[model samples]
Target: MRFRKRVLLYLVPAFVIYSAFMLIPLLMSMRVALYEYTGIGDMTFIGLDNFQRLLFESPYADRFINAITNTLEFFLYTMVFQNVTALLLALALTRGLKLTGLFRTIIFIPVTISILMIGFIWTLILNPNIGVLNQFLEVIGLEAWATAWLGNEATALPTVAVVNAWQYTGLMVMLFIAGIQSIPEDRFEAARLDGAKGWNIFRHIIFPAIIPIVGIVTIMTLMGVFNQFDLIYAMVGSTGGPNYAVDLLGTLFYRTAFGGVGGQVPQMGLGAAIATMTFFYDLYVCHRHALY
Candidate 1:
């Protein structure tokens, strides 16, 4: 009873802090979503009007939808790219090769850098004028591939997703390595005895064993993608560049709720609405994952 009381005392303050900072704000944001704010006087209590306007009436509604779609696309691509690259890298590096430690260090080094710095580095690499990527393409007689990657409407989001994958794949690789290592060697030996080899062993034994890790990584990647704002903001400025091609919920909420380059007045209520929607979407995804 004494130990229990002590643990409760320790947990109480953390719970209070979490409730104050996170739970309270979340509830308040959900409340804001049900209102309409005209940016002048009292916020009118028009329940669900904000959601309707965002989904139906607003001029920027298409942009909002596009941002959501872009976010999903980015998440999907990054999930596949990161997981596949990480798994393959793990498999290759686990073969008891020389310089394995050095290779792992090199791979994970970029994962330690900030996403903003990673964005800036990729920006330089993919810059149309005097960028190394473009120069290499030109040298290889692939000048057509040298177009402005981040500035092109068709390629901006994809370019950013690829850059994100490049930065985080190393971490994913390390995680996959751990997961692979945790699989008992006796299982592999038994599989080998049963004629399982290469892709057969991977498909039957390795993949099933890693489902929990994959689910965890997927959830993390989903949340990261939905909230991704800094890298896009840094690379293409607040506009999300090349005609808002790289926009996502985070950027939309910021621009709508807090004003952007055009000096739009802050509409805290609308911002709250956007945030609530994003929160619910993330929740739904997470719940679905849990169900699965």
Candidate 2:
């Protein structure tokens, strides 16, 4: 009885808080998916019609497909640009370089600011007219290489992806640095005594030890890329402009739910359906990745 009370003492408050904040709202969203209701009156109990339309009908279908396609592409881009680059930077920094603290601080400064702020800052830097990047290119006699980065269809999606990667790479770097630092020093000494050197040492010792961190970083990056919205909205608005080139599921949800685009009438039920799928999708992906 005493042990039960002690367990309940610590667990009850956390359970109550989670139920109020997360579980309740999640249930509400699922319930909302079954009915057609705006923020106004006269909600129609549409059952599965909204979901059918969203999955197989007209405008929603195409946009959902496009958003999903772009989401996957965004993940791929970030995996290469963000995680790989962070690992490289972490490796280099871990090698005991001069001014290591200064460089690490400079790299991590981006992570300290809000994503909204980073988006705005990069928007200004990458602006075609009177932008610093273009001005620098022109000054260096590379004006011919300069183009409208976020404004051009060919470059827009990739540019936005890269910008996100740039902002979050610092976080990945820090995670990797922590992983590297946690490794036992005796392992390195043992490897050296065994006449192992350079790539051989890292291949056998460092990389194997950091596998858990790699999996963690991978899943975190996946979630961030999948749930991306604010940066794209801040940099280019929710339209996912330049021919709807940078669209993702997060932006799609807003447009559908709030009537930001695609239709004059808000499709709250359909939006809820999408949100539900996203939740399940994230859960599944996280579960799979957590195995590593």
Q: Write the per-residue lDDT of candidate 1 for residues 171-221, one digit (tens) a residue.
A: 888888888889999999999999999999999988899888888888889
* C-alpha TM-scores of all predictions: 0.92, 0.94
lDDT of candidate 2? 0.89
Q: Which candidate is the best by lDDT?
A: 2
lDDT, candidate 1, equals 0.85
Question: Whole-model Cα lDDT per candidate?
Answer: 0.85, 0.89
Put down candidate 2 lDDT per residue, 178-270, tens digits, no spaces: 999999999999999999998998899989999999999988988888789999999988888677789899988887888875455777888
Which residue pairs overlap in candidate 2's backbone?
none
The segments of candidate 2 whose C-alpha lies over 4 angstroms from its true place after superposition are 261-263
